[model samples]
Target: MRWRVAFPGICVLLLIAVILTSQGERHVSLSDGVVAYFKRQQPIFAEKTVQLRRHIEQLQPGDSTSLLAARQALRECRISYKSIAFFLEYFFASEAYVFNAPAKYEIEEPYIEYEEPVGLQQIEALLYDPQVWQHRPELAAQATVLVQTAQDLHALLYQFSATSAQVTESIQQELIRIMTLYITGYDAPLLKSGIAEAAAAMKAIDTMLTPYQDLDKKDSIKYYLQQGIHMLSTQPDFDSFDRLSFLVNNALPLQRLLLNSNHDLFSATALKKDVFPHKDITGDTALGRRLFFEKALSGNATRSCATCHQPERYFTDGLMRNRSLTGNEVLPRHTPGLLYAAYQYSQFWDGRVQSLEEQVKAVMHSPQEMNANDDTVLHRLHNMPNYRGISLLQVQASLAAYLRTLAPFNSLFDHYMAGNKQALTDEQREGGNIFMGKGQCATCHFAPLFNGLIPPRYNRTEFEVLGIPAVDDLTHPLPDMDSGRLAFFPIGFYKGTFKTPTVRNTAVTAPYMHNGAFRNMEQVIDFYNKGGGNGIGLSVPNQTLSAVPLQLTPKEKKALIAFMEALTDRDPIAH
Candidate 1:
């Protein structure tokens, strides 16, 4: 009896000690630690920028030795900047743009007045072109601009103060961004240092995440980080790196672990905002929901967002293509379901816009859609009895917010993946296996989200050249004349390429593909089973989809459809 009483007392003492120890560790402020890290990195980046500028200045026209030295210096500067890419991109997006943007500019309708390229990439482009050596003044001017930008970025770091949520979100976002952009060669298209750069990015993330170590499961996160670093380090080259394996084995697990750690450190309420830095809407407000369904924002009194994206019909109008504003002609593309739309990096069938708000603005002004400019829409909204004095920006923000709320991944398949095995039938399970393994669906569509955005990171959306037929009739199979992504990018490889849409709610969002040519899931599957348009005797030289026939049995095709149907989100939109 005495021994039992003594053991209980000892247990209480041990519990008390653990609590005190945790409290002591908590006092070390994660926010302060992150701020200090950036402070240290800021000066390093600045110094490198200065060094690169000096190298550019020292360059002698047509001298190969001078050119090589300058190129090496510029590469060093880029490497230093890449280490803090996550922090710079998250905190100072606009300033980050000044550091690196595409060199090319469009001169037509969507008229972006292209600024002179002025960063490491611009310098790299100049160094590679022997002819550009004659334009020494231009090179020096761009180098000066890069130095100033770096200095400005350093100064901004002084004002940086991270909340626990922001730090966690930023790290998570950067991981995805690295996977989507860095690994895919989107960021360093010219340099082709994707492998080395990805490793550097992972190392930087390791440094940034060091402060939150106490919040993580002991040794759990460290294991994944080390594994990721090791895997990336050992890779021979960018093309040979097993991206799928890395995402499945290392990155996805790490993301979940970090997310859980963040959840443990911060309240869910605090973390429930835009993951991006500057967005105004949180999508949790009643005002946003009201604005989403409001007709006053439209030119036609009866038409609103709900007119095309009906809530009862899984957010699609349930048409091959929705009728135009006048109801006389059909819109160019099928109305993509807004459910899970927020998860995508770009918006629209052609991916013409980046932000959700920007997409709203585009739709509102399109003559075939809302047919109302910002000014006219705002005027109508102000005159509404319930929405008096609403600004155009507010309308856009609210709509974006509401659209984001529609993206809840609570499907039966999600439940099955979360460990409730009974959530899926035997056929559905087989279908999933076929989808992931034999069908080669996961290679492009990815898992969980099952979209081209790619998982573990979800940083970029992919457009694919499928060589889709213009119509369902394959008798004389003509390639779709509607140059999909080529309309925007005007590149030969982008011909017939369309943004890969999410299959989350494919059971309902019918008449699939950008053109809504396929009437059912069977038709869509048949197109893929026979190896896309190329296998059907159409001359598609740049088809991204494999021309080799899948040879999936009819039963296998039915099972695939069953699995997709299971992906339908179970949760109802509260509004």
Candidate 2:
């Protein structure tokens, strides 16, 4: 009798366990898949995705924070419906496989909960593999059916919100394509005969993205397409339609940050192939730009190369005049700024030098500038404690290497021309047209880089002689005024010729002209409006400035100024 009673109690205990298991298994399954996929797809989201998925398992409908975090992580990464579907596909595939979830979730967290019985059932089925492996050959097939069905539902459900609404159409296209490609290969019954339709759409979609996918068009569309791809994340900026448009057309993202930050940040942001591009002058060019500012390596120990080519005020000293180490007011053509100098064919106001390396060593040896001999510089750098780390000769070569990387790529005009329609104000666009056409600025500032002409064959620089009176006495030209390139090469063609500086960073590096004769953009345009240097009523020699006055209205003059500002790389820095 005691044995019989013990048997009934054992049966009762087993029944209790079953009821508990049946109730909780759904929660366990939901938590597992949700957390697993998040970790797999977005390694960044592993911790939070797991935590939230666990909370989702136990909570009553609307009773947890996980759902909110799910919405948020999705929001932050700008993950879209396609990304979500892609996540779910790989996430649930772990059920038949041993994919240990890397993310640890604590399901006990407090939250407003929501529960779906169907979602719970799918999660449990994926978690527990019964002996169906031996008895039912169709069980594996059922797994495929269950997972695909769940993904299709997710794709349709994602459209209810505004953030994913934009790419919802694309998400559908992608999902259908996935189903078409691999779902039919499953050892299962057809859920529906939509396979043929899905296959047809996949081909069509491939053909459709073809035009937009051309490598030639990549730069133009990258900014916009990234928006769509980013929209795949949860925390996308969908509220601001204007930003949505801008983000879609321009993908500055981490690249802009990396460019502006310190070296560690640059490396961390993109340790691999993500770089600032060849135009920024990587490697040899980067080395050259670095040596530009280094002072101790220079001769006399007092001057750095930047003493002439300053980075502040957009790579030029803001001063109207500069003094030499010899205490002579040579004025040296007002020290030309080196903004985007890499884009220019020539190096300086006189174009005496051909390459930046030659220019660096020339200044080192010049009696007027650094006044240090190149050989002396080489000797001094050879022993410096810090520089010994780098070959002294390498540092010499490095400065030239670094100078080539000094091109000013970040400017408003670059943004405007890069297909961001809203980058320039309407007035600025009109001004650009005027400058290029009727304003005659484009006659001198040509295409590709908008300053100096670059031929396909030779990379030599050209110089021009523009006659303008020296500062202070506009009536009489300064005695012993420099004749520019002519004095250097002693060639008549080189007479009064100065290598044209790239007008890219012009908005910031002012006082204007090679001599910095004009103080501001307006004054410069006004000088031009009066018809070059002569039209301004200033008597000058070798006057190559347009002799006839431009006769522009004040509005037109303002437009010209705005356009010059727009020429700035990236965004302009106010002084």
Candidate 3:
């Protein structure tokens, strides 16, 4: 009975001690420590802005530096190309929030009795307000009081933009560290108490005072606070190609449009039709697609896809050496003009890629191409003004949807499809017959779209080994060769196999074959006339090219070339 009575007296004595500590002076430094940090970071941001502006000023239309910057901007702009894909994953893929808890110091509410370390207790009081309990009922129910308390620190960060990044980052780190420590039973009340005072002081003076901020309308320190804290909270993980593809193809809407200036035909083509109606079209175009096209989408400070695939000359760069983001020569392959590529099931001469979007991704990330990765490109895009809420996945999907509208098969040949009689000449007619018969070009290059397909083509991509060697090496063909489809599959069957390309714009896509080996139509015919590539010295183990020769005379060769030339139409083939 005496021990129980003494226990109450001991509790009262301890309560007095707690009150003394709770009302004590703050240990935290605001001026010298927290506020001083952001003041220093301002110049770094300013310098970066200045350099980019100067570089833009120096950009002469097609200069490399400007192009790189534009590329970066484009990459940033495309984050919304999908939706909140990454956001959804971070938000819902897991059951827990990145930071969530409440009641930082569970029982230590300020009252007549004091708590240890006045600054820390004040912070805890702010975090553990009765309003906070009401505001976060869901958290409170789960006893996520600690989580709410931790999250409140991030909220404070957003509110405390007056601090320098160094200060902001330091405070953020401190909050996270303390939360972890507190969770692990560490004593850190003094450290936190001091930080609360620092926050109050910075919030006091972080606004623009007089004349300078007026010209630029500078944002309050809080703007940086929100942005900085939001940025720090985000964590990214790359999805696999299969998963990424599924997410993109399913989650995002594909907007198909007609770049064709003729609105009537575009309307007719886009309209519901019997044979070739497009089920994929959402019947929309980006209001500013032409802006994107002309502006360059690389997101690096460099070249656009248009830099290579120009609309004129059938969508090629029309340059011998394609410049890469690293400002280096892109060796090996010439840029294929973007004509009738919609008919192409495979992309690249070696057919290394499967689709236009995949091809774009390849070029964007290639060291000798755009010389960038997805994140590097996306970071550049995120810095832009117009791209405020867009995600990286959205941008990729948008760009891809744009590419889908590049189908222009309409030439004089399309006129023939419309039942025009005089579009073909006698020579072209005779050559067409030969193409179907003895010429045997039509055996590989089929009709309608002329690109290879297995009648309503889906996943099937065909590869035949056509041995067309370098001009210099006619006699001894080197096996130290780029074996096309063999590179992708790496099997006995795939050796020397390359995809069969559409003969549609064959006239303009000069220097033919996977390696761009042949210079003229005559050379191609002459080689074919002597049977397959094995007729020369270069022989693979299982060559599927015609062992039987075309045996064409000079006239037949010229006539066949004429037929190919007639296949050329104006850019943006009429639907």
The models' CA-based lDDT, in order, is: 0.67, 0.43, 0.40
Off by over 4 Å in 1: 1-273, 276-284
Tens digit of per-residue lDDT, candidate 2, span 22-66 = 335443543343334333434432333343344334333343363
User: Against the true structure, what is each candidate's TM-score?
Assistant: 0.57, 0.48, 0.48
Worst 10 residues of 1 by lDDT: 1-10
Write down the lDDT that model 1 would get.
Answer: 0.67
Give residue 425's error in model 2 in angstroms: 0.5
Across residues 1-575, which tens digit of lDDT does each residue of candidate 1 receive?
00000000010000011111243345346556667777788788888889887888888866888888887787677767777777777678667766665332212223323344556666666666547677578778877887788777657755567665565556666676555556655444445565567777788878765544544554466667777888888983654466545655676567657655322111212122244222554433466678767776667755788889888888888888888989999888889988877766678988777778889888888888888767767777677786787677777787787777776667887666544668888778767656654565655675445777543334446667787887887657877788886788675555687878788889877888888888998988888888788878899876766666778898889988998888887764753
lDDT for 9 in candidate 1 is 9
Among the numbered candidates, top TM-score falls to: 1
Q: After superposing candidate 2, which stretches have Cα over 4 Å from the reference?
A: 1-290, 326-328, 389-393, 454-461, 472-480, 536-543, 571-575
By lDDT, the best candidate is 1
RMSD in order of candidates: 13.7, 27.5, 31.3
Q: Per lDDT, what order, best first?
A: 1, 2, 3
Give, for candidate 3, the lowest lDDT window spanning 10 residues: 1-10
